[model samples]
Target chain A: MLHTYLLSIQDQDPTKPLESFGEKLSYGGQMLLLGMATVFAVLCILWACLVIFKMLFHDLPAKKTKTADTVEQTVTEPVVEQTDDGEIIAAIAAAIAMAESECEHVKFRVVSFRRK
Target chain B: MLDAIKNFLGTTGVAQLFADSNWWQYLVMYVIVGVLFYLAIVKKYEPLLLMPIAFGMLLANLPGADLIHLDFFFDDYYISVEGGKIVGTLANDFTQFLQAIPNALYSITDSSIVFDFSEATLASAGTTMDAVNATFQEFLGNAATLTDGALHIKMSHVIKEVINNGGLVDILYLGVKLGVYPSLIFLGVGAMTDFTPLIANPKSLLMGAGAQLGVFAAFFFALFLGFSPMEAGAIGIIGGADGPTAILVTKELAPHLLGAIAIAAYSYMALIPIIQPPFMRLLTTEKERKIKMTNLRTVSKVEKVVFPIIVTAIVCLVIPAAAPLVGFLMLGNLFNVSGVSDRLSKTAQNELINIVTIFLGVSVGATANAENFLKPQTLYIIALGLCAFIISTCGGLITGKIMCKLSGGKINPLIGSAGVSAVPMAARVAQDEGRKADPSNFLLMHAMGPNVAGVIGSAVAAGVFLSFFA
Candidate 1:
């Protein structure tokens, strides 16, 4: 349909002068010119699409990000001594150190109490 | 010494100083330039351009000022260095060089060296700047920017060479050559127009056609008043108020009458509301003026897209001469209607229209040089243009009354006046007047049918003129 319409337009008023090879033409010539114009127009659209996509995806990410509330709570809230795997391991190590320190203190305290 | 100074102050005294030379002629020119500046600044008529043009005219007229004509110095090449040292002679004779250089060798040296003349074609194609370098070499013969360095062109030598080769030097100052810039302007015009309005309201095509009543009416009036057919046609188009169309028609039909026709058209177009309303009101009564119109039916997207294509085929087939104006208008409208390309349409309506309006305004204004414009016939053209506009308004309003009667008062007679194709201006006037009668009445959309119709009516009228007279 488009091709037929364009052909009909070109066919209208074919009184073009022989000398008017490159002379000023009417609207009919302009319509035919747009057929060729579409090619460059498409190329321009493609270029614009690439630029927009690059802007969307390829730029550097933000330097500072706001942590989600859940993650923030996990990191900031102090763990109870027996809270999780890391806390439990630290608790165990602390208990062992306390036992060793208390061994000397306990013997001395007992001796003192007995002597008293 | 005192007598010489006194005589210098007097009229015959100044004439005696130049030995019967016309010195007052120089003073008169300065006076004219001064008046132009005064009018530009005080009246604020086209201040943006007229001020600069007037200043340029003054500076150019100053004895030994030699600034604007510095370009003329480039017309003839002179050897110059950074420190004003003379160098080898330069040549600006592009055509002569082309003639001398064998086409075969020249093509090898630079296949692009030959003038294409198609850059102009491309510029019209809306492909601006691709061929600027080629344009500089071939058409202008002037180098690109002066940053390219001090250029030399041997004008005297080129003239001698041309004479030796039996060519004319008048061809060198082809700066003001005929047919080049005007056509390029037409190209720019073609690139910038949208034809969708005429397409959307195909019935409004008659409005444009109807508006050209003024063109033909003015033509016959001018002819009856002893102007030639060409002059008559040129004057008649002034009512159309289309600058490029006026330029194209005049350039073809009556190149000499371009100055008057252009001034009358632009001036009247600017004064559309003031010039057209009285005529509209005078022809119709207050009751007819206050008639309300219904809202325009919503146009479909498909219909909008199809409009430009269909109108172009139908209108151009019928009247080939109107193809340019109608084509551009429809094209501009097409851009507007094409939902996929809002950017292009916005550019056409905003940037392209703005830029072209400025150029079209000033260039046409400048063409109204003193000698061409200061004539009894120019006054006649202006008066006839007014009559044409009034008659067209009457034609539209009376036709609108007929439509109103035919459509059983459904059609507003006021909108008939807008059929003069001042676009939304006349339509807005109708809407304004309708609102005055009844506050809730909104006639703007209704008025647009005929408003857009007026543009087509005028183009069809121009085509009719072209068919019969051009």
Candidate 2:
């Protein structure tokens, strides 16, 4: 009788081979690891997809040719001051002269400057 | 005078009210509600959500009231007070308040009508039984659960209980029970959100993924602590620090634990400033905190418009269970960026979200009756939620530190802690820490990358858990 009861107690749990928190702990650990792996995998794929998408669609910078590089002198913007209209005009004149030199064969025309 | 006195004593619920076990529970719940009110109002701890929740808790725990009871929708649930005649004491005890009631009021079967609402379905306790009996006959064999061979009650026992049974709060609770409120809230969140940071620097997605370690860790803890797997899932998602996500997961996994989990999640979110900084400082060195990230390239309008569509496809395909939340979120973002429908975007961001927030907060609060809220398990849930938040912050910081080193010191570890999905709040904390370390460092926009990614990461984790447990 005692032997049968003990067997019944041990065999009662049909779901898992382990008992109580032990079974849950094992399953929880597996899920924990799996959850972390899946989250990372999903996010990483998203990250990669975004990178690829951005790169594929992004406007690639125009390739630098010898003439293009020679003509394209990087001009820094002059910081504007409230009362520096004289200095601003001088800076504009210098930029115009440089641009005129870049395309020496073209005739230069000036337009009126109106601050909006 | 002697007859009137006898009648008052006989009709009043003063006898059974004190005799019931729920009396002390109600008393204690009142005190608890008072504290919540003080915290929400004076202390301003998440007052937007907390104030309504606290008021709901107060309404639910008020003695001698059936404003938020689980009674059915039969005609017997109400009392007829037409012509000011005391014809019925259906279920509620009106006592002296009966004089203040309207000509007609709906009362529960076993109580007298104490309040008045023009919208209520009214009947007499004594005279309407026969007619109500005829109506009850249609639902007689519809649904009933056997209880001690006497009282039989269940869902089909009532028809349209959402509207008929619940006076005010119960009507709002329908959104919460059906998971509509949280999903709608996600739409508003999506509209308000700007994903440019995440788009500019996609690598922060890994840090967002890292922060979710706290979510699964807490699940493990809850299981060991003896919660069922479903209950553990609800408790665990509080670590995600995303209130709507927590509500959605709990509504699926363990609806019973919803109130406690929602309260813990929102309360802790409000406390992020106090809760996260210490762990962040403890996890990383001063030098690492001072590292500044280079400026992100300006994201174009096309990228913004298409980003939501791609993310929705990937997330939904990967975790179909997260479709309502992540799908709505992405949809909201699409509406915002597509710029075709300014009306829809404005609605989602402001009017729709604010309305849903009110319903979600009060309804969630109403679910926490004295019976459920006043328990040892509630304390355990609160503690476990706090631990989960702390561990999640630590996880993000730890990953940030590693990433900072791997990038040849380009990444600031401070931004990693923002990966726990508290939105601009967590990001702000990172910026604050960065500013403290070096006055010139501006980490706000940089931290936003991981912060927004954390939202997606948590939603994905929620989907994974839902697949397992739901």
Candidate 3:
């Protein structure tokens, strides 16, 4: 009744197994443990293969910029300040100055000097 | 005129019902059919299959109805198969059996020729009466002879029987008895499925595998409750939550239990939304439920094409008994993913599958004759089916929680409940619950991974059960 990776071959009479309750449960338990393990093993193999394939073929990670690296939490969004329009720059500067005036020690930068 | 009236009254269904001593069976059948009809129609619970099934149940259970009736070997209609050997199979083919012997019902004698059909006896002694002894002996040797000149077989109504008196449901029941319907249904399922989600996240395969814990668990419970192992195997498959698989396994293992087992399985499938949520919530934290799965990576077209072939090779090698259902399922998928065979795929999913589904549902439903479906065992099947379904969802959710923990909160535990193979229905329930937790979260595509995995997992489970006899 012990479940193993190799497929167990049972040629017991179908009717005989039903005759004894303990024997049926033993059969049931064997199937349970073996079936689950087989399922997990098969799926895990596929998962591992997928991970390896992704690692070998997917685009390489982009270099982390100073601004992005400074962004402390994965939950936080990176602030970008790049624009061709003067009006957008003024709006960004106004917002940054407004926040900075409250906390004088705060420092900020326009990470991208080109048009976004 | 009075004699004609009496004869006509005697032939009427009402007259037959009145004369029948088993009136309670009729009453119970009517009530059961009525409830099934209400569920399939009034409540719209899997009406596509259930309504036909309900109607078929009604037809088969009616007193004096020819539909689904077993024509016993009485009235001198005799058929005996001795050791399943046929003495004159070449001489008495089914075609000759169909033609009623051309006014010459010949009997086999122990003579060297094996039949006494000489003109000497044909003229003086028609020999049909005295030949009964010889006929019975040859019958034991698998030569079927009818003194009444009707084609005699056990549970096999011939083409002539169909032309004369066979009902439509009886004709359809052949599909169920021969075990063709479930595999055809799988073909339809394959054509309709998109396995990208599964290919994208193979880890969900474990969730599908985890979900089958219900199947094994329920099997032990059923056996403990004193069901025969075959009967327990049928009941246990309900935990797989795939209607076709349950029906197929029930048909193979315990055909007498098919009607009850199928109805219980499909009823639970229809009620997946109601049955799954409480377990999903009970098994996981709000934080785990709210976890958003990363978007599935797009699978290459080549991968989709290769999947079915690989799965078939691996699974069939392991459990050959599952090859028919799983093979047809993968063939349907191949027809779909090949992209050049839209017509083939459409036919499999829509036309071919639909035709088989009608036969499968009605015929399987017909087997719930009053003598079978009215037992306390039927109630137990229903109760155990519900238990299996709930516990299966729990199994999936428990696995999902573990995966969620291991994946650093990327995997949503709610998607675990989708591992039961009720198709998009189980996935939809997960989606609906996820939306309630976080409106921005969409769990459908992610849940689909486990949903479809449940299908493959259940088929493998069925194969494991069938391997015993195979």
* Best-matching candidate per lDDT: 2
Model 3 chain B: weakest 10-residue lDDT segment is: B72-81
lDDT string for model 1 (A1-116, tens) is: 55664555444432222123222232223332332233123223323433343344323222122344445665766443422332233234334434433474454221211111
Error of 2 at B221 (Å): 0.4
lDDT of the structure predicted as candidate 2: 0.76
State the fnat of candidate 1 relative to the true structure: 0.00
Which residue runs of candidate 1 sit more than 4 Å off their true CA positions?
Answer: A1-116, B1-203
The positional error of residue B216 in candidate 2, measured at the CA in angstroms, is 0.7
Deviation in angstroms for B145 in model 1?
Answer: 36
* Residues B174-235 of candidate 1: C-alpha lDDT, one tens digit per residue: 21123333333333343343333333333443444445556666765665556655566667
How well does chain A score by TM in each candidate? Answer: 0.28, 0.36, 0.42
What is the per-residue lDDT of model 2 for residues A17-50, given as tens digits with 9 covering 90 to 100?
2347666776677768777888999999899988
Cα lDDT, model 3, residue B259: 85
Model 3 lDDT per residue over B259-345, tens place: 899999988888887888887777877777777776666565666787788777767776788888889999999999999999999
TM-score of 1: 0.53
**lDDT of candidate 2 over B101-211, digit per residue (tens):** 333543434333343232223343332333433343343434432222122334343435556545677677767766788889889899989898899899999889999
Q: What is each candidate's DockQ, to 2 decimals?
A: 0.01, 0.19, 0.15
Q: What is the TM-score of each candidate against the true structure?
A: 0.53, 0.73, 0.74
Instruction: Quote the positional error of residue B199 for candidate 1 in Å.
Output: 6.3
